[model samples]
Target: MKKILILFLSIVIFSCKKEEKGFSDYLRSLDTLVLPQKFSLNSTMNSSNKYDSILFKKYKHRWTYAPYGIAFNNERIVGIIEYSIADNGLAPFLITFDNNGNKIDSLNILGNSSFGMKGQTLESAILDTNLKLVVIDSSKSWQVDIDANKIPNTTKLRVSTTIYKIQKNGKIKKIK
Candidate 1:
């Protein structure tokens, strides 16, 4: 009887252990997370700059739900880009957190022209050899005639491509 009881308790204790979510798990769950539109400066930068910014996500003058892509460094930073499809545009933002998933900051990248992350849906994000955040932006736009209900014969299609690198301090520097 004691042996059986001990075995049952051991099983219960092992089953009760919670599984921790990793960075990859967070990336897979991005579609369900509502990203913050604005962010305060990080502590390291806040003391020197005292900066604040408001960000926006809109396509064709209307607000929409867009989940594009996410990238993580497995340590401190995660960047995500959401895109709107009415015409074509991207809203990229950076999220910083501690090892315990405590949010540090959510800095907007789409607002910065130097980031070159606007006007396209982010395709992919990865950390490069230099540990800089590298992202690829792509989009396709076509002009249509409302009266004809078809694309205009003379209308030209527009495609934009941008590759960007984000620095460690949350500032974006255009790469291509």
Candidate 2:
């Protein structure tokens, strides 16, 4: 019975993840991730403080929009974006663009802490066939919040989450 209770609680906690509401919700998440499809190499990247060239659109503003890793499916260009706000930290975006600068699809995935709580600072991301996202969090174990009752904190545990199946509807299904 103890094992059964634990299993039941696990299911409950896992199932509590939010779901995508509708087209509007999905669209809002993807809007910030739109990118150029046919991108040329950056000849002037990392030149100087006043960098010149047209390959990168990122600047040292209040936030950073950058790419960590990218995956390609056949000819489709799939890119992962790591955007960090002023004091908030980094957020991940899974995006796919067509050959004509059109966005095929995008997924705005949030980072989770080792405490199993939702947070930020996603380091890298990769998308599979079903749009399932494999994310790596850069937040160290000490970054996760801890409280009483949630006793015996895993000081050695790090923030990491691997989502199994990303439904066509833009919902993430986490796998153990």
Residue 130 of candidate 1: its Cα lDDT? 53
> After superposing candidate 2, which stretches have Cα over 4 Å from the reference?
1-53, 58-64, 85-88, 111-131, 134-176
Model 2: per-residue Cα lDDT at residue 167:
42
Cα lDDT tens digits for candidate 1, 1-176:
99999999999999999885454454554542232222212111111121111112211112323434444444555554443322223434555444444445554443332212122233444444453544443443344466534454543334344455555644456676
Per-model TM-score, in order, reads 0.34, 0.33
lDDT of 1 at 60: 11
Stretches off by above 4 angstroms in model 1 are 28-66, 71-76, 83-92, 96-102, 109-165, 169-176
Per-candidate Cα lDDT values, in order, are 0.41, 0.40
